[model samples]
Target: MNEQSISQNKIENWREDRLPNLSGKCFVITGGNSGIGFEAAQMLGRRGADLILACRSTQKAASARMMLEATSTGTINLVTLDLADRSSICRASDGVRAITQRIDGLINNAGIMQTPKCQTADGFELQFGTNHLGHFLWTSMLLDRVEAAGGRVVQVSSIAHRLGRIHFGDLMGEKKYSSTKAYAQSKLANLMFAFELDRRLAKAQSPAIAIACHPGYSNTNLQSSGPTGLLNMIYKPLNALIAQPSALGAVPTVLAAAGLEAQRGAYYGPTGFFDMRGPVSLSHIAPHALDLERSARLWAESEKLLGISFLSQD
Candidate 1:
C-alpha cells in the first residue's frame, strides 16, 4: 500500500482494536454538556475515563451528568464555566483543581461560532476571547496538573480555519467585523495555539503534549446557536442534508484526547468529501496556522492582551 493508504489502514485498525483502557485517567472537557464535547466525553467515559464537564449552565450539566452516569463506567462530575468571562474561567480552574490533582486530558472544546459582533467581559471580540483566550487562560492555569500526569491537551478547531488569516493589525475586529471572518480567525487561533504550545512543551522538556482536531460538519446545536439571519438560514438546511451526527463528528476529538496513535502537534478530523464526515484521520493544517513567526507573535500578543505571562517558567 501507499503511505496514505497504510496510514488509513492503521487508523482503522487502531479504532477497532487498539482503543485504550482509560481507567484511572481523568479528563476535563469544556462544554461537555452538549453536542460534540458531550459526545467526546461519552467515548472517553465508556473507556473508564473520569470526566468533569465544565459548562455554563448548571441545569444542562446536571442533565448531561444524569444521562452520562447511566452509560459511563467512570465518575462524572461538573463545574460551571463561562468562557466569555475570565473570572469564571479562574473559578472553574480552581474547581477542577479541587476535584483532581492530575488531568490525563484537557479538552478545549467549548466555543461560540459565527455570532453577531460583540465583545467579551475582557473587551475582546466575543469569539476570539471566549474560543481562544478563555481556553488560553484555563490551560495555562491547569498546565502543571496536566504535566503532572504526562497528559495531552486537545484543542477543538474547525474547517473554517482554512480561510482564516490573523488580523494582527485589527485582531479584535474593532474597526469593522464580519462574523464569519471572526469565527474563522478564532478557530485558526485555536489550531495555531496547539502547535505553538507543543513546541513550548517540547522546549521545556515537559511530558504533556498538545494536539488539535476538528469535528467537520457535525449536526449540532452549534449551527442553531449564535448564528443569525443568512448564516443561520444556510446552515440549518445544509446541516440536515450533509452534516454527520455529533457522535461521528466527535471521533477526531476522542482520538486526539485518548488515542495512543495521536501525536503531538498533529491535527485530526473526518476524512470524507470536503472533510465533512468519515473515518477519523489526520487533517490538513492551514499554512497560516503553520506560520511559526505568526504563531509566536500570537502567543506573545495573547499574553499581553490577557495581562498574564503564560508558561513563563517553562
Candidate 2:
C-alpha cells in the first residue's frame, strides 16, 4: 500500500486495554518524569507494576514518583541516572541490584533530541552517547539479572530513524554536526541494538526479548527541546496538528512491555500516516537496521567506546 493509506488505517484502529497480570512485574523507565516515558510509567504503575523512575535529576525523579503514587495503584521509586555518563549508569544499575533480585523489564526511554552540538562525559557525541551507548551499557550490566528473571528490554526508538544513516568514521560528529542528523542516527542505533540483542539472545538460548517501539509524533517534551528558532517554529505547529497525546503515544511501548504475544526483535508503532501517528501495530523494520554485519560492528564499537564488555565474565 501507499504510505498515506497505510498511515490512515493505523490511526483509525488505535486501542488500549489493561494487562492485569503485570501487577507483580518490575519495570525501570528512564526519563519517567515527562512525555511518553512518564505516561508509560503511569500506565504500568496503574496495573500494579513496581517502577524505578530513572532520570538525570533527583528532584524530577522524586516529583515523578509522587505523581505516579498519586495516580497509580502500585509502587514507584526514584533513582538518579545520568545517561550521558557511563559511571552514572553503573551506579544506578548497582543501586537497582542492591535493592531488587529481579528486574522484569527495562524501558530504554531516556533520550535527547536536537540539542546544541556537545559531547557526553564519555566523549561521544551527546545524542549518540546518551541515546544509544548509555542504554547499551545499562542493559549489558543488568543482563544477568534480567536473564535470571526472564525479562524483556524495550528500546524506545523513533520513526525519524527511517531517515538516519550511520556514519561510522564520524560517529562522534567531529567533522560536523547537524542536530537533526545526530538525533536520527542515535535513534537508528537504538533500533539496531534492539534487533541485534534479540539475535544474540536467541543464539545463546537466553529467555529475554529485545523489542522496539516508536511514539510517532507524540506531543511530548522532546518537541519542546528542538534546536530553536525556525526549526522550533516549524516543529511546533506540525506537532500540534499531527502528534498524538502522550497517553496514546505510550500504547506501542505498553504493548511491547506487557502484551502476551510480544516477540523478540518485533517493532511496534502507530499505524497512521508515515507512522507518525494511530493504533499500535507490528511496524515495518528498516533493512539496514537488520544488517547483521553492521549490528555486530556497532556492538563491538559500542563496547570499545564505552570501555565495557557486554558478555558475562563467567
Candidate 3:
C-alpha cells in the first residue's frame, strides 16, 4: 500500500498479547539474560519464536533459559557474546550461524550505561566499543542471514542520546572523559547506526530493515552494572515512583522487532512525560541524529576500527 493509502488492519497498540504468532521465526537477542532484553525474549518466545540469547556469562544464560523454558512455547538457546571483545563477538556469531541459516530478527539490546572510564579488549572506549562497535560488527556479520529471512534489526538506544556528542577528536575518551557524556555518545551512535544501516539496506535492495527503540525509565540493573554512586542511590527510589517495570520497558523494543506498524529507520520509545515512561509510540529523532554526513563518517570510522566492510564488495 502507498504511504497515504494505508489499511486500518494494522496493529495500533503493540503489546505482548498482540504479537503475531511467530511459529518458526528465530531471533537472536544480545543481553537476553536479564532485564528488558530477557523480557523481550520471553514475549517473543511466548508467541512461538525460537530464541538465541547471546550473553556474556553462560551461567546467567542458563538461568535465563531455564526461566524462559517454563513460559515460552519455543526453544531457548544461548551463546557467549562479550560485546567488549571482538574475538568473542566473532565466536558468538559463528555459534549462531551454526544454529540457524536464517535469522528472523536481531535485537541489539545489550549495553553499558554511565561507567568509569575503561577500554574494551581492543583498547577502544568501553561504552562505544561495546554498545556501538560490537553491535555494528555483530549485525554486519549476520546481515546476509537476516536479509535472507526478510528479518528486522532492533537497536535499543536511550533518551540520554539527546545530550550526546560523538567526540571524534578523542573517540576513545583518553583526552577527556565523563561517564554520562560517554554513555550519551554510545547511545547516539546506536541510533545513527540504525538509521544508516536502514539506508544502506534500502540502497542495496535488501529485504531486512533496521529499526530502533528506547526503554524509557526502566529500572533495570543497567545502572548498577557500572559503578556504585549517586545515580545508583537515587535510581532505586526514583524508579519506584516514576520508572515503569521491565516488562513495560520492553514494549518499545518488542514493537520495533515484531509490531507490523514499525517501518524501516523508524525509532520508537515511550510516548509520555518527556518520553520517559508510558506506552510506546513514534519517538523523537534529534536533528543531529539525521545528519547524513556524520552518519557516513561514523560508519567509515567503525569499519576502520573493526577492519571490515559490509553490503558491498569494495
Candidate 4:
C-alpha cells in the first residue's frame, strides 16, 4: 500500500500472518464443503481448532473431511444441515448440541444466491430461508453454548446488500419475486442480524461478540450452483478476470473469526474501491443496516416466525 493508504487505515494493511494456539478451540462453520467456507475451515483447522462442518450433503462432507484431515492439525466432524428446511435445521442443532460443550466460534457462512423463485420446506423464500432465517435460528440455538465459551459469531454478508430493502410485506416472495432482489434482501438481513446480535450481547453484558464480513468478488461456485441465464454465461467468462480466488476471498472471514484485535459489532471486508477486492478492513455498512428500530423489528419478526426467543432482556 501507498503512504496515503497506510495513513487512512494505520493498521499496516495486515492479513492473517500468525494465529494464536487454538489447540482446543471449536469452531462450527456452515457450508464448509467448498468455496470460501472450505478455505476458512482449512485456516482454522491448521490452527488446531476442532471443526464441525454443518453442511447439506453428507457425500460432499465426506470428501471435504478427507481433504481437511490430510492437512488439518485438529479433528474434523460433519453433520447434515439443510438450511432450507426447518426440520433439518432443528435436527442438525440437536446433533451439534450432542458433541461439544462450548463453541469457540460459529461462522454463518453458508448461503444461496440468485436463483429462480423458490420456497423452502416451510414455504419461506429460498434466499431468505437459507441465507438469513436458517442461520438466525441455528446461531440462536447455539448462542448459549457460544456464550458459555466466550466465543464469537462471524456473519458473512455481501456488498450486494447495498441494493437491498427488506420486503417485510412479501418476505416469502409469494406476491412477486426477483432472484437478485431476494438475494440482496437476504444478505442485508445477514448484516442487520449481525449488528443486532451485537447490540443484544452488549445489553445483556455478555462476553460473546457478533461480527460480520464480506468476501468481495470471488470466483466461487456461488454463481455456478444457481440458475443458468445470460448473466451466468457472461459471469463465467468474466469471473477469472474480475473475481479473486477463494483463498484470498476467505481472508476477511478468517480475520473476523480469529483476529486478535477484532472489535465487537465490527463489519470487515475488502478495503478496495467499491469493495470488490483488496486487503481486509472495516467495510462500509449500508443505511438500512443502521436503523436500530428496524433491526429490532426484524429480530422480533424473526423470533415470531421461527418460534424461538433467543435473547430476553432481564
Candidate 5:
C-alpha cells in the first residue's frame, strides 16, 4: 500500500508495530526530562537508540538520565537547551553538533503553554518566541545534520491549534494580549512549521521529513506551570479527572519519531472522544494549518523575526 494509505488504514493496529532495533541511531529530544518527552525518550532508548536529552535543568536531566540508564540499553547523554534564549540555543546547537554528526530524529518537543503576558530572553512574546521561534532556529541549525541521516523532525503541537490565528500585525501580543490566544497561535505555528519544513525538504529532494503530533489531554506539569489564575485553578482538577497518562499520550509522538509507517508531513495523535485521549492514529489537520500562503508567510516572518535565513536554497 502507499504510505498514506498504510498510515491511515493501520490506525487501529499500528500500535502493534514493534520498534526495530536501533543500536546505532541517534535522537535529540528537547524537554526530555519530563512529561511526554521523557516518556517518548524511554521508549526510544529501550529500543537501543542513543538519546541526547536537551533540557534546561542539569539536575532534572541528570536524574532522568539515571532513570533511563537503569532500564535503557543505549547511551543517554544530556545537553542544555533553553528555548527562550538565543545564546542558549546557539550554545545548545553547538553542544549537540559536538556530540554527533547526524541525528536520526530531532523531536522539537519543548514548549510553554498559556502564560501571563511576558517576553522571552530575546524580547518576543513568551509563547511564540519559546514554542515556535525557538524551535525554528534550532531546527534550521540542525537540519543539515538530520538530512545527513535521512531523519525525521517531529513537531509536538497541541489541539489548541484548532483555535489559532497568526497575528502577524500583533505577533507579540503588544496591542492586545490574551494568554490563551497567544498559546494557541504558537502551537499553530508549530504544526505549520512542520508542514512547511516537509514541503521545503521535498522541494530540495532532501531525505529528511517533518511530522507533527499532539499529546491529546495527557496530564503534565504544563497545565499547572504555564496557566495562571482561573485557568490554573480549573486545570488542576480537570487534569486529574480527565487527562490520560503521559505514557499513553506519548504514543503518537513515538510513532511519529520511529514508526516506519508514519508518512511525511502526516499528523498523529489520540483518536477517540474529541481526540482528547485514546489509541494512537492519524489525526486531523486544521484548515488554517494547511493554508500554503499563510504558512509561507509565517515561515518568512519567522526568519525575519529571528534574524536568520533558513532553508532559502535548500
Candidate 6:
C-alpha cells in the first residue's frame, strides 16, 4: 500500500485480523475510561486479553469496566489509581500485585494535559508528576512482575515533545510555568524513560521490552482540561479540523503493545504530516530524548523522590 493510503487505512479502518493472539495474556491500562485509552483498552480486551482498567475514580473505572465487558469477549477488571498521588500509586501497585502475580503488558496511558499550573498531592508539578513520575514509580514497583511474564511497557507520549527541553534545575516548574511547557516536558520524559528502561533491561538481560508511541492529533478530551474560556474557543475549531478519531490515534500504541516487529526502545507514531496524521510507522527519536546521561539522572532522581527502587530488586 502507498504511504498515504496506508495511513488513511489504519486510521479509518479496523484491522482486527492483524491483532496477535492474546488469549492468555494480561494487561493493565491506566486512563482506560476515555478517548484513545478507552479505544486501546477495548481493542485489547476484544482480542482476548485479561484487562485491568486503572482510573483515578472508582466510578469511572467501574464504568469503563462495564463498557469493556459489554463490547469485549474477554475478562475485564476495574482498579482505582490516582497518578497525582504517590500514596495512591503505591496502593494501586500493591493491589495489582496482589491480584495478578504476572503482568504481560502495561500501558501507561493515563495523563493530564495543559491544565492550570497545580501541584500534585506529593507537591510536584501536576503534569510532570502524573504524566511521568507516577508512571515511573508505578512501573518500577511492577518491574519484577513484568519481567516474570516477559511483558512489554508502552509509554504514551506526544508530538509536542519535540518542543520540550527538560530543565533539571526547575523540574517542579517553581521558577516559571506554562501549561504547554509542563505538558511537553512530561511527554519528553516519557520517551526518555522508555528508552532508559530498555537500556536497563538490556543490561540486566531482562525479558521485558519498553516502547513509546504518540497518538497523532486525535479528537479526545485532552484539551478539555486545558485553559478554558477564550483559549478553548480557539482550539475547538482547530481540533475539529486536525484531530483524527480516537481509534485511529490509538494505532501506534496498540501496535507497540502487540506488534511482533516492535523492538526495545522503539518509538512509534503516525507517519504523515508532521506526525499529526498518518499511517503507523517507526517515528523519529529526538536526540535529547535518547540521552542516556539525562535519562539515568532522571531515573535516579525519580527513585530518590519516590522512594522506590527497581534496580535494587532481583
lDDT by residue for model 3 (1-314), tens: 11122223333455667689998999999999999999999999989999999999999999999999988998888999999999999999999999999898999999998889899999999999999999999998898889889999989999888898888888889999888889999999999999888888888888999988899989888968884588778777887899888999999888888887777777788878998987677777777888888988899889999989776424
- lDDT (0 to 1) per candidate: 0.89, 0.82, 0.88, 0.87, 0.90, 0.83
Strongest candidate by TM-score: 5
Q: How far is candidate 1 from the true structure (C-alpha RMSD, Å)?
A: 2.8
Candidate 2 CA-lDDT value: 0.82
**Winner of 3 and 6 under TM-score:** 3
Model 4 pairs in collision: none
Q: Which numbered prediction scores highest in lDDT against the true structure?
A: 5
* Candidate 3 minimal-lDDT segment of 10 residues: 1-10
Over the stretch 221-308, how does candidate 2's per-residue lDDT look in tens digits? 7877756677788878888788889898988888778776566677888877888777678786677777778878889889888777
Q: Which stretches of candidate 6 lie over 4 Å from their true place?
A: 1-16, 312-314
Q: Return the number of clashes found in candidate 1.
A: 0
Which pairs, if any, clash in model 1? none
The window of 10 residues in a row where model 1 has the poorest summed lDDT is 1-10
Q: Evaluate model 6: give its TM-score.
A: 0.92
lDDT (10s digit) by residue, model 5, range 231-280: 99999889889999998888888888998778888888998888899877
Q: Model 4 — which ten-residue stretch has the worst lDDT? A: 1-10
Off by over 4 Å in 1: 1-17
Candidate 2 — which pairs collide? 7-272, 7-273, 10-271, 14-279
Instruction: Kindly list the per-residue Cα lDDT of model 1 for residues 1-314, writing each as its tens digit.
Output: 11233354335412523468999999999999999999988889888989999999999999999989877999998999999999999999999999999999999999999999999997999999999999999999999999999999999999999988899999999988999999999999999999899889988999999989899999999889989999899997899899999988888898889988877778888878887888778876667788888989999999999999976533
What 10-residue stretch in candidate 5 is worst by lDDT? Answer: 1-10
lDDT of 6 by residue, 138-165 (tens): 8988888888899999999999888888
Q: How well does candidate 3 score on lDDT at residue 156?
A: 99
lDDT over C-alpha atoms for residue 30 of model 1: 98
lDDT of 4 at 17: 70
